[model samples]
Target: MNAQAVRNYSNEFLNIGVDAAALGMSRSVVATTNDVNAVYWNPAGLVNIEDYQGSIMYASYFAGIANYNYAAFAMPIDKQSALGVSLIRFGVDDILNTTELIDSQGNIDFNRVSLFSAADYALTVSYAKNLIFKDLYFGVNAKVVRRTIGKFANSWGFGFDAGIQYERDDWKFGLMVRDITTTFNIWNIDEDAFATIQGAIPGQNQELPETTEITKPKVQFGMARKFDIGRTFHLLTEVDLNLRFARTNDIISTGLGSIDPAIGFQLDYENFVFLRAGVGNFQKTTEFDGSKSLSVQPNFGVGFTYKGIQVDYALTNIGSIGNALFSNIFSVKIDYSFFRR
Candidate 1:
């Protein structure tokens, strides 16, 4: 096959998001993220970490056929700067390899069958600093991505991201640019392993696949505000607009780009018990009658914190909106300072 650069759905695993809190909010926390998960959302929010923080999350997708995991750690460099590291992995394991199932004598050989996994991994290093301007913060991320498909092919990619956050009183705003300089992935295919499959099909799989992939830039703008309810309850609401430079099924689509809007709300009692809900992923779907209808995904979550240890749970795609299956996500966070006391 001719070598070509793929422009769509490259490195899509990164888009799955990290942390239960953020996913529960449909990733509307760009303006209010202030924990280890910020390493993936808006690194600029890492500056809000008071001390060393660590977080981990786990989720299963497609009815347990795939697994996703995330981990992150952040610490303050000083009073005005912070640094963080994060890793994400998404994979489907124990896939049966059938390429070698046929013996040279034209006999079926079940003994030769093997199992492998196809997985994608990403590592991000983030830095956030408080700017000279009051309530303004800046952050950047350096990312490395790796992908593997059993022993047949593998790829390596690199990218950069930049984000900024600004606050005025109870209102906050944020902007995040992913793949600011465009990300590129180069793949290497093993000819030996590929040869087995090349002959398995008459005309299909006769040539090598594309060797390059390009991920274009994407931007997200966010706004958030906090409201006080009496003296014991607080509500935080956020809205985010995700922009992609291609037409899609998003609610707002045009020739130049598409805009997908998301909104989230979080309520807390004395910052200890939390309840969250979000709506996002608006799309126009075609009905059986050739009519288009709007669909939205709704998510819900709950959390509890004690002694700086927080646990969160989220139910995503609650009603199976669109073609996505519902998933249950869980996450835990720990503050080192809590152990010091």
Candidate 2:
């Protein structure tokens, strides 16, 4: 499997949430700099900013996937305690639908005409504090989701995220687990939909047709180190391991064990701007072909923070195609934060 082939999504909801148009395309992962999304990318990063700051992020991705939006606020509750809140939203525009069905005349008749869309949002609250030797941050997220199609409800589910971050003199380490105890039950599921599925003969009541939400285990563990190579210049290196466990009907994509590792290096100049370029095995480093190849192997990014504003951009490959995944393969991200006493 190509490094880029390493993929995981807890809920099917993510299928519609992952967009190519969004920034951070370099790795098909969320972009984090100075925004509330840091709460998701890595809650420990939330403490890197000022004591009291508020931020917002907006990412438009996948020509039609969605508009990913995030907002957050962090405050110092006391000398050793800090609290924060963040929100994330993803969804699509309305869609037109017209399914063909046989009418009473044994001819095709499409009577149901409707428009619908699917979207999901999650809210998180985080906290960080210093331990006996260094900084230790613990955070949790609560999410409520709803999915619908036309006049019928598709499914709805709830999930949570917990993470811990630790920092020392020259390194930073963090761990996170997401999507714990999640389920989906759609609204108004017509019994006819399951009349025949998976080669099962029609049955009068094997069980109520309920929404089946996708569930998976996701974990992220990583370390980042800083080095002083020259005067007024710094080098930052980061390596992370991600594992995903999930059961899916999609055979090729289903399984419970897959390991993904990512590494990146950035050169900082004058404590203001950074020139970054690194290659990581996103999914798999090689492919089924007989030769070694990099699928989504290159990550090039540039970021700078001046005053109260910060912006970053990165480029990657959705695949080796010159179409939408090529030219639009680049992602640009902008974040704004306000500091208050």
Candidate 3:
């Protein structure tokens, strides 16, 4: 089978929580993150955090049909080290299960029209410190993931991520490896609960879904440069290369394999306002005529900061895939420098 046919994976929620700024920049923050959100982007950037930092974010996705939320807190352990924790939740609520049941007389049963919820959540504990070498940093993230469907079925998984960063003058570089141990999801389905589903429809025969899925590791390398146009205005440009691997076969039929490149730009006015834009997720898709074409998505966002509080918003275009309006993302961050060095 081709890679596309066998591309079954689970726990995709791990990729849903993009901070507002990063989302605005089309997730081009791998080499530019410098706050609590670093825990989700490039943990190595955490070392740049001065004292204590916290972030909270929420987005109403898919026209409010679903939602995503994130929160993170980081504190310096010492002059050269820091610890952080992050949580993410993505789910849909009150979905009406329209599967109906009929009585002996073929009468409709209202009880069968129930509601259920499906949710995915993850918790990540991260640690970062400056490397022995100057201007270098390293970090790691330990994560636990859970997915549930109103209790009928649940899955649990664990994964870890590691990253390294180096900075020289106004240039920054980063390398991140996600799912370093090859994450796996073990699913447990309640047969008894599902038995009712089978009995509801006399001629229906349903089989249990797969119990496990393994997600391979992915690597991202990024570079960014900051231009101090003036003491009050600055520009940051970044590019990231993403690579996906497969177990035995080539990741994709394309000789280029699973490689995607993303680029972003951010403009800042002093420390008060920000503007960002980016394009990413480059890929080749077969057209109806059996011809392949290149495609990508464009995104943009804006932000404002005052005192120690910051707010950011982004609009991410899903292109023709979603057949809907752009996704709206937002986030807030606060830094407490009470113990600043």
* Candidate scoring better on TM-score of 2 and 3: 3
Task: Give the TM-score comparing model 1 with the true structure, all chains together.
Answer: 0.96
**Candidate 1 local lDDT, 175-226, one digit each (tens):** 9999999899989999899887886665885768888888989999999999
Which pairs of residues collide in candidate 3?
A: none
Better of 1 and 2 by TM-score: 1
Per-candidate TM-scores read 0.96, 0.69, 0.90
Which stretches in model 3 have alpha-carbon errors above 4 Å? 1-8, 103-105, 199-205, 246-256, 317-322, 338-341
What's model 1's lDDT at 336?
87
Worst 10 residues of 2 by lDDT: 16-25
Report the Cα lDDT for candidate 2: 0.52
CA RMSD, predictions in order: 1.6, 7.2, 3.8
User: What is the model-wide C-alpha lDDT for candidate 3?
Assistant: 0.81
Residues 203-295 of candidate 3: C-alpha lDDT, one tens digit per residue? 875776677767778788999999998689999999988777643222133443466678999999996899999988665666788986766
C-alpha lDDT score of every prediction, in listed order: 0.91, 0.52, 0.81
